[model samples]
Target: MTWIHLLSKSHIPFSVYKMYKGDSLIQPKTIKNTHILVILQGILSMYHVLNKTEVICNSIVYTGHIITSNDSDYTYNYISLRTSYIISLPITTTDLNQYIDHKIFNQILYNYNNTLKQNIDINRIFIHKNIKFRLIQIIIILSMKFGIIHNQKIMIPLIIHKIDLANILGGNINTINKILKDLDDQKIVTYAKRNIYVHNIVFLKYYCYLLR
Candidate 1:
């Protein structure tokens, strides 16, 4: 269990929130404070609409992960990709002093922030011109998020929508479809009924080298 779950069960200044699919989390006129959330159930997506026709998906927050937002980061509307439950907690200087084990708690916070930083940096793949590289990057990100290794293949536990993946990767639907089909044909990955299973981690992980 994560720190947020510990905080919730121990009654350490946290609240469990339930959000349904398509519910708006932040309004256009809303200004929020610095806070953190732990997704307990489903995925939460942050997106912004521009000029009534353009929609940009900024990020997708998954289950068992922490999401933090400050004033500058709350510009997009955060919506539930599916029905989700989350834990919301404030993280003030005073709150830090209240932790029962500040050292471990501090370490947890540090580690989570580091992962968040990596997530932000890796998301730049959306700008890459190579669709193959872009899809590989997305797969790496998802593998880290929800992968379970079994019999040499890494399988994501959730049923991920290919359309959502296309939006996230900043690629056309047809391109994503083609790449996925090719991957399946090449035995590098297996995609069926919205489920993604990686057959060769070594082969799949090779594309991540381009990032460096």
Candidate 2:
């Protein structure tokens, strides 16, 4: 069962917030009660603010992913790449034991575990220095998670900024643009203004294999 199913069926209290594209959802500094944030719809980029100015995007969060309070020690700013619906559920360690046998709790645990595993996989990608491979792998992951088939091509529908992409991939903006240009030249993918249309998924996969 998915988190949406569980949320719909369970009696757990949740508060939903709506955001427009490019809207910033600021993390409250004085949250007295701990709550789990779930992305019910749309995509968001979680950024870590440094010195109250510099921002570093750490992850691309899609629907069904859970964000816990302990995930970051610094303040987080969630920026919407599309219109998003997020729900906050107040949950505590002691509170979980009461629903241990329920499907709602089980589904929550499943999603949480998957989220952790995905984070670990993404972290491993950073260990490699090859920016091209890293970028392609990230696109593959995004396509699998959220891309839609349009005219036989996989289109990542989110409106992402070039700077955000660079921050996530840990590459320079010029380098990222050049790599994307090379892919476009080969007709493997079309990237313009943050929208990516992957025409040849097979070629992307094989290219990654060759790079390894």
Candidate 3:
């Protein structure tokens, strides 16, 4: 995926939504109102039992158009593959009509829609390489968004685990562990108590290039 555009602001009311691992915020049950979900941080997975499908992070799900489970007994899980930040757009039909008619908002939406439609094919043979590239890109973007000055280190406070990393990278736990160990050995990162201290951001970026 490429940085097609960045949305610094939104006309709609934006809330910093957060979810923990294994937490179910939106059950399978459908809501009458419309909502737009934008993944700002972290990763989440949505499983559609009816369609036997699952969607991973960086996916925009339109709740109004999708039919999900309505059974009260049906339990839908919104697992946080990792700690996540999401923007929820809560708008009624009338609100949507007015919002969509705005030229600026429409243009932003159009570009994102087009970007979503572009196909980026991946193969198993090259999956690891692709994942490393994507993760490194994500790290850079997050650094821009949330980096902090800690002992002169550009540290990201998010406590990400191996399982979460695996989910985000579309790799398995073993692969993530190996990568983390390699980085640890190189003194690029130090992991303790779920906290990842990036000792050398420059070297990390360089390692990402090596993978490429």
Candidate 4:
């Protein structure tokens, strides 16, 4: 089931809006409306702009994410990585608490838990690994989430810049450049024409020896 399914019985008021590429889904400031932001379509990336650099807070949110500001202060900034559709539904903690004991809520909880597990996996994969290994592992994770297979190669949906990759990896641009070079040299992955294509998954997996 999808978020739409969960919202079917919801009488809470909502407003749907289209966000083009480069639009802000949520600004870094407090909001009067305690609305739950839902990704209706396409991919969205959560980012924090620090010292004029975009630090990735979350990987591409594929779907089923409910962006909420339960606290009084809200400052999470979300940007459209691709053209996307989104809706803001006004909700309260009381309203959410009421649904906590249902089967539908359990399924939603599972989805959130799955996303948490992916983050944990990423942290583990990147920790203490060399730049080349971390770079390859990240490509594998992105491929699993957003890749399309063609000619036995995996094509990811978005343009991947070295800086963006660096931000995701928590590394410097020069290091990411070096790692990208190594990945290309090893035939593990390559980013070109605003897209990343994984050339060989089986060989890449062997290189990473993914334990999970």
Q: Please tell me which predicted candidate would have the highest TM-score against the true structure.
A: 2
lDDT of 3 by residue, 1-212 (tens): 11112222334454556766555556554544355555555544443333336534322122111212234544444556456655555456775665443553565466455434421211222245566566555555445545686776667666667676666556788876776677678887666676666776888788877877
lDDT of 4 by residue, 36-145 (tens): 56666766656544435544454446465555534344355677767777776555687666543365467557656755675567667557447667777777877887
Candidate 1: what lDDT? 0.70
lDDT of each: 0.70, 0.77, 0.52, 0.66
Off by over 4 Å in 3: 1-18, 25-33, 38-93, 97-135
* Full candidate order by lDDT, most accurate first: 2, 1, 4, 3
In model 2, the worst 10-residue window by lDDT is 93-102
* Model 3 lDDT-worst window of ten: 60-69
| Candidate 2 residue lDDT tens string, 155-175 | 998887777678878788998
Q: Residue 210 of candidate 3: its Cα lDDT?
A: 82
lDDT of model 1, residue 143: 78
Off by over 4 Å in 2: 1-10, 26-33, 50-55, 93-101
For model 4, the run of ten residues with the poorest summed lDDT = 66-75
